[model samples]
Target: MKKLIEVDHVSNERVSNVHFSLMEGSLTTIIGPSGAGKSSLLLLLNRLEDPDKGEIHFKGKKISDFPISELRRNIGMVFQQAHLFDGTVEENLKFGPSLRKKWEQNDGVKLLEKVQLSEEFLTKEVENLSGGEQQRVAFARTLANNPEVLLLDEVTSALDMRTVELMEELLHKLVKEEGKTILMITHDLKQAKRLGSYTLFMNEGKVEEQGETASLFQHPKTAALKHFFEG
Candidate 1:
């Protein structure tokens, strides 16, 4: 598979000398203890926060070479908390595409369906939706931009177990059908194990171990990783 994004010795206030490559159409989970820089690493991917040093390349070109808006649109981000505009769900879904003048007549309904929301949701107010619904709307809104890569920062953390499971299912469908490259951050080891095709285990701002999910979990090579699974 092609490498969609490459992180080369990236560093920031909270992250240090981190390195990894996101494979196209792959789901990679970033896991570690609190203050391990998972969120910081994600911010660098979408340019929400720039690294103090090192470079990030997208599709063999430097990320800095791409226009910020273009780069961000192609690499969308969904945070733990869904931030919706004070408007109808359809309006929120239209926000990103409208900015780029790429709005389609059926985009709102199509995206809603993609996120498992019905057409009727188009008329509902975002604030009136439940947490799970809001998160789904957020995902749909990001999808409207037609991003190739999705940087998910603990997107399921605030959701209930059922909601989280639904979100995971939706994500799997997206990977299988839409071919989205997802880089997710999670504190839940079980969720990571279940969803991640590849896993990166970090500590003290550095990646300590990384490999296929089953291999890393079943045969950790580092002492830190062994203790993490054992404990």
Candidate 2:
């Protein structure tokens, strides 16, 4: 498969000299201890934060080469917090496509359905929704833009078990069927192993080890990774 994203010796306040590549249509997970720069790495990838050194390339072009609006539109991100606007679900779902002058009334409903939310949710207020419901909306809003790559920062951390499972199922469909590339930061080791085909194990601001998910988890090459699995 072609490389979708390439990070070369990238560094910032949090990440240190990290280098890796995410293959097209692959589901990869970033696993590490807290403060390991996992979230910071995501920020740098989408230009939410620029690296102090090195560079990032997406689909063979430097990320800096793309216009900020275009880059963000194609490389979308969803954070742990829902971060929804103060409005009804329909409004939030329409935000991205509307900004790009591509909005259609049916788009919101379809996007909601993709995230397993029904059409009735379109009229409901975001603030009134439960944490899981709000998260699904946030995800649906991101999907409204129809991005090629998704950078998820612990998006399921606060969700209940049932909702988390549903979100995971949706993510699998996205990769297996929709053919989007994904790199997710996850604190749950089991979720990482189960959800991702490839895994990057990070610690102390660097990717200490990376390989196929099962192999990396079963036989950690670095001491930091071994200690992480043990802990």
Best by lDDT: 2
**What would the per-residue lDDT of candidate 2 be over residues 140-197, giving only the tens digit for each residue?**
9998999999999999999999999999999999999999999999999999989999
Alpha-carbon shift of residue 11 in model 2 (angstroms): 0.6
* Cα TM-score per model: 0.96, 0.99
Q: Which prediction has the highest TM-score against the true structure?
A: 2
- Give the per-residue lDDT digits (tens) of candidate 1, residues 137-192: 99889989999999998999988888888889988987878899999999889999
Runs in model 1 lying further than 4 Å from the true structure: none
Candidate 2 residue runs with Cα over 4 Å from true position: none
